[model samples]
Target: MTAMRSPFRDALTTALLLTAAVAIVAAIGTQLSGGTQRIIIDAMIKMIIVLGMYIFVGNSGLLSFGHIGFLGLGAYTAAWLTIPPSIKASLMPGLPDFLATAALHPLPAALAGGAAASLAALLVGIPLTRLAGVAASIGTFAMLVVFYAIFSNWTSVTGGQGSLYGLPVFTSLPVAAGFTVATILGAAMYQASASGFRLRGSREDAVAAQASGIDIRRERLIAFVISAFFVGVAGALYAHFLQVVVAREFYLKLTFITVAMLVIGGMRSLSGAVAGTAFVAFLSEVLRQAERGIDLGVVSIGGRLGLQEVGLAIAMLIVLIFRPRGITGGRELTLGWRSR
Candidate 1:
């Protein structure tokens, strides 16, 4: 007898369950989940981060060690736009005199911020996408460093090492959850699209793609621009969620964590995105919890195990030892299961 082909059935259940769980949590934040609600909110934020990683690393088959820079750009852009003129005058004493006099709403500012970072990505992607493999990787890393340097020195706009606050908390649990669901669904849909197929084909074999009349550079540019747009949106989400923007938020460490999520999640598959994002987001929270302190009958460790370091080390070790291909191993969880 032929065994049933229900491989994705189980996975689809898991994805649906995850989405349902998020929806419930988002709907009942603070009302339930008690003190853990903030943690759930943060997990949703990380989901956005992982989704950003999925576009470039998953679809394009390129390792971009620098997309986090878009986060910083978006953060500052939104922060600048949301900040009241009176507040801006105080913290950012030297903000462009024009900006000090300008008035903008938070929602429009979010869009503007996203567009700003996407434009930057387009400019950067135009040349960088031409390089493939590890070379492209290096180029993205350079972009991150360049972005970081600018944010650090461009105090007039970014507030430098200082914090830029005053953003209204327009983004909350439900909004974030809605976006997480959308990004996951969108990324999965993108993978199955004709354009995504062409991009994947180019990533797999540029020479072959060129022989088949595919423009390798154009594909890369397209993927890069698209990736940048989402990343920027993710940044705006982050900015609104935090209600503050700072330079240190998307430093090299966050970049490493983002890369780790992609590598572990299976950069080539949508299942990998969901699995990797959920795993990393939830695990990081657990680490945070354990770091705060685990109670024991006899004695409590008092939570101070330096959870950040421990979490990263353990995450890397787990990915390397148990499953080098990351979660889902590049397989996607989709509606295909229903038809099959």
Candidate 2:
């Protein structure tokens, strides 16, 4: 007979395994060219974002399309703090004196970005968390739209549809991998926490959860804020990686891809989040290469534009058709052993 593992231990094991997997990928990327390394870094960043979504969407069983808005908020915040004051003055002339002149290190600026997103989540979640089902999803989408509109039109702070350049490029493969590991561990820990369980209970059966004295709304709000923080951090990393920030990049296209990654991986499981991201990232890369044309020795075959999106959509449909609970069937990855 085997002793049952504690939830904390299980969560730790899962996080460690996932971190090891990410490390392996990062190691392989180092052997490849710089472009490939960038792709790996970008994928790890996306993993962080997906894990953030998993924390809220997986635990609360709520679908949110607005999480990327928090990413945008984080990116802009990092830009505000880290960009040279001289650049800020010319690019964003309407900025307040403090932000205009203040330049910070990338690490703290990333944390500040997370904090900014967390605050935004807290403010929006107050009322939004009260809604459930499709209503809540729509509300989140509306929030995304609102964020995009504000970021696009707010010329002073966000640069108003213009790309914010001159950001110090500090996101390397190791940096992204480290953050990815931290995010995976954080997500696993959160899923094992009391708040996480309560929120999941509400997701499974709201009435029963509420009857058991669970404050569903409050739990949801907590998850929302926490998830936003992780995504915001990813946003800061993205800003540093690209050395540029564009409002449009944080809008609908990103919202769709991130949500799709979560859904395809098994939104209810941490392992699924990791797996889905890896699978989709690989698939997207393949499709992108094919779009650039594949040489078949005798004849070259090329794919049209939008191949990546189309391929992802088809892949998602096939996965949903066969595995309705996502590729992991809503199960965490674990050693194949039974506890007694």
Clashing residue pair totals per candidate (backbone < 3 A): 3, 0
List the global CA lDDT of all models.
0.75, 0.91
Question: What TM value does model 1 have?
Answer: 0.88
Q: Give the per-residue lDDT of model 2 (tens digit) for 1-340.
A: 1233477777877788888888898888889999999989988999999999999999998899999999999999999999999999888888888999889999999999999999999999999998999999999999999999998999988899898988997899989999999999999999888898889889999999989999999999999999999999999999999999999999988888888899899988999899999999999999999888899999989668999999999989998899888888887776642220
Best candidate, lDDT: 2
The CA lDDT at 181 in model 1 is 79
Off-target runs (Cα >4 Å) in candidate 1 are 1-21, 28-30, 302-305, 335-340
- Tell me the TM-score of each prediction against the true structure: 0.88, 0.97
Clashing pairs in 1: 264-326, 292-303, 293-303
Model 2 poorest 10 in a row by lDDT: 331-340
RMSD of each: 4.3, 1.9
Those runs of model 2 whose alpha carbons end farther than 4 Å from true positions after fitting are 1-5, 337-340
lDDT of 1 at 69: 92
